[model samples]
Target: MTTTQDFPAMSGSLQEPAPFWRRRTGTVVTSAALVAALFGGVTGGVVGALNASGGGVAAVSSPVALNASSTSDVSTIAAKVLPSVVQVNVRSGQGEGLGSGVVLTPDGRILTNNHVVAGAQQVTVTLSDGRTVDAAVLGADASSDLAVVQASGVSGLTPAKFGDSDRVKIGDQVVAIGSPEGLQGTVTSGIVSALDRTVTVPGTSTGRRDSSVSYQAIQTDASINPGNSGGPLVNAAGEVVGINSAIYSPASDGGQAGSVGIGFAIPSDQVQQIVNRLS
Candidate 1:
């Protein structure tokens, strides 16, 4: 019955969209049964139930920019970005849920998915150096599925360098970092499989059942899982091009969901736009 994990898919449009089957993360069962749906104006297939699943601009200062042409190796990228990634844990009367986040400022401003902290009463974040600190939600926008949390009395934290997602192209190398299944600081690599993908998920700004949050997501082959939500999907240059969000997992016999190479991230530009407001 935890709320942070499930992210049921919704339908929308793209200039030239293609049909693709999609689903949410986690195995936690909710009240509803699984149902089929379309994504991006194409009759893809059924979108799964909620598993129960950053930015830029003038409002926030930028991190040191890495040389995009210098390297795209996983180790180098992970080394540069790891310090900014964190494991986010939330607790409510209903229960607890886990996700991830990216540090936005040295003073401890963080960027994460709105669903990760939705309905959360207490929130804490584990930094890359194994420090768990208390945090307070500064703002949350369900329509964009983005949020910002500020850690108490923390300073000198490394903020992630964000790249321009609009410049990302298919076949570009990318790396995803997050805490999957509570495993903090895990790193995975893949390519930009597609772009301008319209993905709709089950929550919205109005908190209405009929309304959904539709966003243009960056499609990738990176192995994203449940706890990976809100993590950084970085480019080879060690700059975050997107925020790792959801994955499209086919239903298995046990009804458990895992990454099947089809993962989606909220474009960094959109993340910047939303986070600039949230932070």
Candidate 2:
């Protein structure tokens, strides 16, 4: 489930927003049946049976240790943002999807990719501390492939600070945090590779996985995978700059093709615009 791999897979044009659905880098399981569900109901009884295993914001001032040129700032950024990030596992009657999300409110608002929870009858969200909570879809937009969910029993949490994507520059150091292939709390470091690039991806919320949506994106070399969808891409200062939404892959099945260091995220400015409309 690591994004450190830098190799080319099948040659061709690039496809966007496909879940890092391949074999999971030998760690993530795409099928909800095989992956370890952290909660009951849609996530299976695993979490319920165990009563859940154990386990956000500046309540966020920036971590002072961050050094853009030192290379060690990746951890500082991850530590500041991971608390707001979560692992999302969803199940519908016929199928399921696994992805990551970020907490937006102390009272349980969550933001994630539409493809991850689309049509899901059941959704289980695992917090950074390992506690799992059931969630319900509140709103979804297939056109942008973004969605929001509401979780029960949460309050007074730290929210992620949104950054101005228009200010993001090429080669800026960044960090991506997500549960790639169901592996929670995974962090990858890289630089913004491109910005304002248009990407077209199939719609997962409508069940028409073959359909496509076009939107401007923030491209980064940070390691993002199939399960990394909807996760946050934070800057050196720990403010979320974009939502990791898609990646450039060449596989036809889409699932078989893996990341080649090129990944795309929905910029925070656009994300905030959409969230404002939905919320």
Candidate 3:
């Protein structure tokens, strides 16, 4: 039996998936562990959706100005995409946890994993300019593992350019950006190893045993870890194609699950649809 466990949620629940599909030959494993990439020790506080607009993603900034011939340039892509990504910090009754978010609109609306801000009492985000600002949860959907948060009174922010996930092909170069282990502005690069991978992760709410979220994921080899949840996985054109969500870990890793070159992301096309519903 293949074993899959979600990265540590704030509650540290051990979630298992339905069944494992054998795609690679000679890759025999008795169990597969899928862990939530969001932090575990720090739980988020609960918040209601404040007044937010369901405005579509803005085409602000020039984050897609890479050379057409070379979409795999990490340095160029990182510099352009970094500003649109932010570090999300949550404080709750249990403790404080940190994750990552992608800016959706210029007026401070952000997109991140629902688990990142789930159960959070207070939420704040640090922009790439090193400015930290208070934010509020606009809405969260545990079913889709997506959420929308808005930074208070913020403007002139750079929104990420979302790409067409449907057009993402296997082996295409991609970049992952987020704060892992509280290290903000971290960047990692890899290729899209697979597509339409089914990933199921537990919700962030406490005391709900049946609370879980499942979605078809874009699998990549990027180095994703705890606190990298909700960060953007962009294509070579600096377009956000997916949101880094979960990773596969060997059962023997002893709970110290880091990226093993098999990370999964929520496709950006789904992200845009959910953000619209939440916002």
Candidate 4:
């Protein structure tokens, strides 16, 4: 089932569609035994999104340095950041969800949205290098909508550098990297529309704001679609500033879904704290 969240205060004569948290579905909890289910070097469709963006993509064979010196240009930043971003495919029994993730460490640690991997029975991470590896969730925090997963066996990983969201100013140039509509490694560009915006989400509990989860978000005008969840929202310098989480679907055509040039992300500062505990 597709679910969304929005500002309850802005109710109109015709209620608008709530912004969707994640475009996909699935909530079956799997055990750690899943780590041994897949055979080594045996690749199967992991049910993921394939990311593609406006600018051209660099060859997956070339090693793009995550710390490469980058100017305030979009292509330059993408070349550096793309190598660190990954496509996350999760399956929970008969249900499956698609999302994106950023490499947090050279050892294959990944950071993504909790809604993306929550209750996932199996997870497969596809690197920019065209290799897929098995992943296991370390921990998930629903309050922040963030989660961390670690690869069982992987090497030569390129980790994205996260920036200080506290010093981020409004109108700064930014980019969104993720798999939109099953397109993996897609990049989109935009400016920071707002800062520290308060957003409420439908939580594990039911009934309106009583049991909702709120988050301090970094708002952007980037085109983040359903599959973009858990991807990294990076700065012009190729540093990750936030984790792409939700998008604002406008009240049009009976509330058409997808990004309407309005997207929200969990600030990197909050993500850092969550990943710290997971690591």
Q: Pick the candidate with the highest lDDT.
A: 3
Q: Report model 4's TM-score to 2 decimal places.
A: 0.73
What is the lDDT, from 0 to 100, of the residue 135 in candidate 4? Answer: 94
Lowest lDDT 10-mer window, candidate 2?
55-64
Kindly state the number of residue pairs that clash in model 2.
6
Model 4 — which ten-residue stretch has the worst lDDT?
Answer: 53-62
Candidate 2, 142-220: lDDT as tens digits: 7777889888787766677777777777788777777765678887777887777655544455543534566677777
Candidate 4 residue-wise lDDT, 173-263, digit = tens: 6777777655777877777777765565433211111233567677677776656677887765667878877655432222223455656
Determine which window of 10 residues in candidate 3 has minimal summed lDDT.
54-63
Root-mean-square deviation of each candidate, in angstroms?
Answer: 10.5, 10.9, 11.7, 11.2
Candidate 2, residue 199: Cα displacement in angstroms equals 0.5
> Given candidate 4, what's the lDDT at residue 115?
60
Candidate 4 off by > 4 Å:
1-72, 204-210, 252-256
lDDT (10s digit) by residue, model 1, range 1-279? 111222334221111101111224322333122211111111121232222220000000011122243344557777989999887777643356667889999999999877667667788888899999999999998777788999988999999888888888777876677776566777777777778765555552321222456667777776665567777877767788887665664433323245657677788998988898887
Residue pairs in collision within model 4: 49-182, 50-182, 50-183, 50-184, 51-183, 51-184, 51-185, 51-186, 52-186
Instruction: Quantify how close model 1 is to the true structure by its C-alpha RMSD in Å.
Output: 10.5
- Name the lDDT value of residue 217 in candidate 4: 70
Ranking by lDDT: 3, 1, 2, 4
The C-alpha local distance difference test score for the whole of candidate 1 amounts to 0.60
